[model samples]
Target: MRTQEGDKTVELFLSDEGDEVVIEVADQGCGVPEALREKIFEQGVSTRTDEPGEHGIGLYLIASYVGRCGGVITLEDNDPCGTLFSLFLPKVKKNDDRTINPIDR
Candidate 1:
């Protein structure tokens, strides 16, 4: 619950009924425009130009990693201002009810 004009805030929520884990990150900087939202996650796409050699691969990597882990990531506008990123990851379930042993063990 951070409140700053150019700060980023992250919050995590777990559902009781299922294995759904919700992660939300919100930033209060110069908000992303509607037109570039779709392409923001594409490879080699960056909005920061002040820093030299800054490759905009953050969102791209996030999306890719989440997808590889059988999760989903979405970006949207935060209420009032800034951008909000959401990630949903499903937890793995164990089949055996009687024994809960570590896989390595």
Candidate 2:
């Protein structure tokens, strides 16, 4: 981690974008390495090595769920440090029959 606990902030932003919703989570920790950026979402891939049993499947699972829901997730470097995760999901709408439908892109 770049900043010690309580020294940095993790920010989240949400906004409505027409048919979709944008969600962003930005942290002020050690930024992800360039070499691992492309494969960060793959299972068994992770940056933290200090933990005894860190599986690194968290992001992979998240990606899987997002894909199934017809949403998209992306990882990027934060402003000065840390990592930023952005998720764009389709908005839910109610049909005339009262059924719930999540917009598909």
Candidate 3:
């Protein structure tokens, strides 16, 4: 969904979900299409065409980093308009001797 400049807004939310941290970014812009929703995080996939040779890779890198941190990423539709990107990242828990690795959990 395309929104007017006045309607453009980006909202961020961070929440503690027990063992994971929830990070959500919602933007009021041209939302991701249903057809591209699933592949939005894949490499070489992008909706922005205003720039030449500068498409994709962003979400791919984000997904890769999130995965390496033992986290998961999700895409959803924002209310009214736009796309919502959410990342559930594992919290770094510390033990008595040292900090525990998120991946080891």
Candidate 4:
């Protein structure tokens, strides 16, 4: 992870394990409070106004879309401070019968 400005840092990781691929985005900012952790994915829920045009839909949309793709999303504490978002996506191998219909969405 590399620090950007101030004490902020962002990190991304990707790995493949078994039948799924994992993606993690970690940030060293004000960590999500324990009280609001479960409600963070709700629409219009936000804690920080530091970023420009942060509509608070990123998590909500991520959860929604990941769910539609039969994947899982999780959040974890990033040690001293910050949050880690982990996304697990099931691989769709070639000739796989599982079809993802985006138009029906």
Candidate 5:
């Protein structure tokens, strides 16, 4: 996964096996503590200071969207120091004429 400070680094990996796609995002900023990992995904939960226009909904949104898409999202510690977010998405199948053939009647 990519690593950055202000911005998030996203890495997409496609598995040759089953329909599984893994996306990893790593940040070089302050890493997440194991204690708050579960709570971080809750709505309005934030490590940042409360500001006039700051509402903590980042991880909440990420978890929600990923769940709706039939995927799983998890948070882990990045080596040295940082936060790593991983998302797993199931592959979708498409049916086309080229993928099927008509049998003789």
Candidate 6:
């Protein structure tokens, strides 16, 4: 929740959509510029100008793991402020799995 007097906060939500698990992590911090959005996923592209040990490889690690799991990851601008990282992972099924597996694109 957001209020006019308070600062933006962090939020996380997990949901199941048909056969995929949708994961969303959002924050109310300064938003990422459109030009640097994809670049942030690359190493040595840190948004933290004031902090040390700022290697922009955290997202890259997550993305690599997600890729190995056959999942799709995306980043988008969050309303009001902040960035949204959304992941759609294939639902693991036991016995007989019926959902279509996500293809890496």
User: Per-residue lDDT tens digits of candidate 2, residues 1-105?
Assistant: 334555788899999999889999998887779998999888889888776886778888888777766799998889888999999988777653434354343
TM-score for each predicted model, relative to the true structure: 0.68, 0.79, 0.79, 0.79, 0.69, 0.75
* Each model's backbone clash number: 0, 1, 0, 0, 0, 0
1-105: candidate 1 lDDT, tens digit per residue: 444444555544444436667777776655677777888888787767566896877788787777766788888887776677888876666763443233231
- How big is the positional error of residue 37 in model 1, measured in Å on the Cα after superposition? 1.2
lDDT of 4 by residue, 1-105 (tens): 345546577899999999999999998878888887898888777766666776667788888778878999999999888899999999988888877555242
lDDT of 3 by residue, 6-92 (tens): 646688999999999999999978788898888988888998867688788889888877988779999988888888999999887
Alpha-carbon shift of residue 17 in model 1 (angstroms): 6.5
Cα lDDT listed for each candidate: 0.70, 0.82, 0.83, 0.83, 0.70, 0.79
lDDT of 5: 0.70
- The 10 consecutive residues of candidate 4 with the worst lDDT sum are 1-10
Which stretches in model 4 have alpha-carbon errors above 4 Å?
A: 1-7, 49-54, 97-105
Question: Model 1's lDDT to the true fold?
Answer: 0.70
How high is the lDDT of residue 68 in model 1?
64
> Candidate 3: worst 10 consecutive residues by lDDT?
96-105
Q: Which stretches of candidate 1 lie above 4 Å from their native place? A: 1-17, 94-105
Candidate 2 TM-score to native: 0.79
lDDT of 5 by residue, 1-105 (tens): 333434555344444446777887776657876777878888887766534766667788778777766789988888766777888976666652222233222
